[model samples]
Target: MFPTLLIVDDEQPILHSLEGLLSDEGFNVLTAPNGYECLKTIDAEHPDLVLLDIWMPGLDGIETLREIKKSHPGIPVIMISGHGTIDTAVTATKYGAFSFIEKPISIDKVIVAINNALNFRKLEEENIFLRTRMIAKNAIDGSSGPILALKQQIIAAAPTEAGILITGENGTGKELAARTIHQFSTHSESPLITVNCAAIPEALFESELFGHEKGAFEGATAKHIGRFELADGGTLFFNEIGDMNLANQGKLLQVIEEKRFCRLGGSRVLDVNVRIVAATNKDLRQEIEAGRFREDLYFRLNGVPLHMPPLRERLEDLPLLVERFTQSWCKSAESQPKSFTPEALETLANHDWPGNVRELKNLVERLLITVNKETIDLSDLPMPYRTPDVQVPADGLDELAGISDFKEAKAAFEREYIKRRLAECGNDVSATAKSLGVSKSHITKLIKP
Candidate 1:
């Protein structure tokens, strides 16, 4: 549908002229003779753009602008004034008006302003919609067994305004977990600010989390807004919290407990209503025992502890993960979708994944690029994963030498060799069995024990 425009003016002639001019320019125009009528029209029509006159009777332009902003902040309003002044333009701009145009209006200028305002409104609305979708996707995709259960628990606890401490190994999607909780929490509509505890220098960590007033330091030219202030009425995700210094941890605990903090070089205390979500790879309990972390701070942040399992423990989900990664990479590369052969898949399934899901994803991407085959086979597998002999121990014969019967000895060797090959190739049983000159099902049976 075409965008709608609202024209507000006390002069009937001006309003009539604007309605006709803008309508001819392909806008759905609504006309109002006074501020009250303009507001009423806005409530009813919900126009995309507004051409508001500054000298309207009853409510006047500034008051009307304020009301419009409060009711529909996303809609862009251009302030039109016959006796336009610098102060009037500044006030209108400050009250969220898109632009101020002086009267004795030009039809061309009016059209330009209307089009720009409407386009700006469209872009802003699109951005908000995209951000909302991203947050929703993160929340839904975060569900993976233990993580999913923890997410549900977080949703239940988030509304209560309790502090949260998320514990997991590096790259275990801890940040994603924090974001999911924040998005589902009572503060879902509010900001979710993040601060990297490990990235920030120790000396500046306190000032970054809690704002510093002007003159607080040599480079303090102006008062700074800190993460806590920015996250007011929302959530603050402190990533790598275990890396925070002992001194800063104490201050953080105090502010979290009191819900208030004073900026550096400032005597006045600023109150905040923010939910804290701290994430760390290290064990804070150990840090406390070592006297590197404050015990009190640990308890304060551990209100609702959540631990995410590493990717290795969830090996059953590898196939699903690989499919997802491959599809995503294909889309990004603008290439046709690729599939893995049974041998290729078995090769992947047998490996001990040290780097977890992240490593697997990287390997999949590498295979897609390096392997030219439409259906990746055993030879297409990377060097480290090509065969079992390289990674398997040479204690091979010694381990199988105990079997007395020839049939038993051969079967045992076959089982051990197939299993080792599968592990080296990432678990491609077909590829491993093929390399061993045996049927896939035979290798599968031998390795069943």
Candidate 2:
């Protein structure tokens, strides 16, 4: 679509000339005789760019500029004046005018101004779209409950400059939560840099966090910007923060407290404006007690703590999650989406999801690729999850009769059968938990007593 431009001037000759010139330049042009008509055209057409004459009857250029800025700040407005002065131009610029063009304006300057303004408008629109997409991906969807309440709390707290601490088991969407908070934050327009504290080598932790000057250490050839410095005017997400070395923790504390830090082997301090969001599967409280984590740093990072419940706690949402994953996978893979039979869904929901949402998503993708059936059924499940071994014997026993409480007996037998299978799986908690369709923590709790 051609970009739209609105030209406003009391002089009929100037308006006709501008309309013809802009139209010849491949722009969709709308001409108005005065500021009042210009605003009305703006409301009606929502033009991408505006050319307003400074000396108009009734609502003048300055007043019209204020109204346009208040209503549609993104629309670029260039001021035109026949009796142009430095003071008038400065006033127009202060009131958010894109540029000022004097009367008997050069056609080339007018075209250039309109083109630049339209380009800026495009960029602003794209940024808004990207932000919206990020927020949509992070939004929580489900029926009302504690999960809904938690989502609301996160949204409410996201815009603040608070340092958030997110705690959850692996694959429980801790990263998603952190992103959601950052998306709605004051620093949303800024970058959100992530560092995996557990993944980084301990020897290089300081240089990584605080950066290093050229030749600061062995193999340090060039000056580098650290994650903290890069995240200035934005957010820094430290994943698995509990795994950071103790010595590095103290340095991090000083930086967080002072909002300034010097690069390694550098004398000058660099100031930063960054909000911190840290996440870890490990219990930081326990780590602190064990002297593996700093308590002072913990307090600073835990300005607002959000705990993401494991998948088992919100099992009711599993069906919806599964459908969402199935659709997502199909789109990415360019294949027809698959659906699970009621029995299959029940089996899926009953099994403990050891790896949480990540595990479930992986399984869904696996099923989409491997399972050929139009509808996944019980028999289509992998070996360990097909059915309890003891159920085979029960199937034969129904003919023998005299089993008055068969339901309770079946339940007991199934429980014991799963326990035996779990043990046979080497007590590799995650594997056993996945086979049994339960969370690793739940499996641990079961076997603990």
Candidate 3:
């Protein structure tokens, strides 16, 4: 696309000359008679660059520049004036004008200014894109053994066309794992379409997945492309797939089994080349046994099982995660970088993290916004994560006294913690499980002894 330029001047001959000159130089030119007309044209057509004469009847170039800077500061504006003064030029520059050219305009100088401004905008856009991609990659950043293994597993599975089923607690980075795979795959350039099974209504399932033709159903005023077709030659991520009803499970199974599906109210068979990646926090085996999920669908979806360990289990990576979150958030907030005290980091690592990595990220952001100190201490942590008093009896350590390995010690500590929480919650299995950030099945196992 050619860069568009909007020229604003009260002189009719000047407008005609600039428009013709810029147009001949491969610019899409727009002419406005005065300041009001310039703003009106700007609102109607977002031109890449603007040229304004300082002397106007109603609103002059300086006033116009201020208004433009307030709303569309990204656009570059050049000031033109015949009665040019040092003060006038400085004021234009102060009001955010890109450059100044005298009334006797030099075509060469104008072209050079136009190219420089456009190139500047392009560089700014590229920086934003690179930063966004870096942040996405950092979403899965971890150095713990489990995370290392998970990364290696993703690297191996990404190149294949096989389906992936990711299981873990909520906020365990299941979606991030799927994205990591997509980024490393042959279809990395293609879209990674996502559908949250739990969020979609059961009534809209067919239309949502297969799309609908115009007048196919109520509110089908126009033809719609469903998730399946939209994800052609890409990836389809079914988040919380276990939440899908059994009836929908069978329909999805059919789609997976045969890559071809017909749109609703349409007979044409459309073939799609999409890789399926599913995630769930629920135990699908139990769901299958209970007849809430289909056994056949389970076998088909679990092509390469990937499980994300909860944050508590990967406590060794807390420091790295905290540092990354801090750097990322602080940069976004445009503030000086903040460091966490050793005591504070240790407190964060020791927590159960029921909400997992997401919970930690939220805490970091909260601290960044709320805490005024340069160094975050234990006191800066939320009340729940701060050092707890009198929760676990000293006698609890006796059972796991000889467990020297970090993993074994953590397991023992978690088991004992769950036991105390259960007693405190009055043996309410559900409440205890919720408080401790584990599933009921896990709590039951802890109470087996």
Clashes of each: 11, 3, 0
Listed in order, each prediction's TM-score against the native is 0.58, 0.83, 0.59
Tens digits of per-residue lDDT, candidate 3, 68-125, equal: 9999999999899999999999999999998889969988998998898889888878
Instruction: Give me the runs in candidate 1 sitting further than 4 Å from their true place.
Output: 2-132, 136-144, 383-449
TM-score of 3: 0.59
RMSD of each: 10.2, 9.3, 16.1
- TM-score winner between 2 and 3, please give it: 2
The sequence of per-residue lDDT tens digits that candidate 2 reaches over residues 164-223 is 999999999888888888998999989999999988998888888889999998899999
Model 2 earns a TM-score of 0.83
> Which stretches in model 2 have alpha-carbon errors above 4 Å?
383-449
Best by TM-score: 2
RMSD of 1: 10.2
lDDT of 1 by residue, 1-449 (tens): 88888899999999998898888888888888888988899999898888999997789999999999999888899999999989889999999999989979999898888788877877888977986887765752324576567767877877777778989887677888888888778887789999999999988876898889999999999999888999998999999999988888888888988989988889999999998899999999989999999998888889988887787666556677777778889999998899877766776777777676677888898878755445666766766666665333445667667778998888777667666667755688765655555678886787775
Worst 10 residues of 2 by lDDT: 389-398
- For model 3, the superposed segments whose C-alpha errors exceed 4 Å read 1-139, 389-449
Q: Which structure is stronger by TM-score: 1 or 2?
A: 2
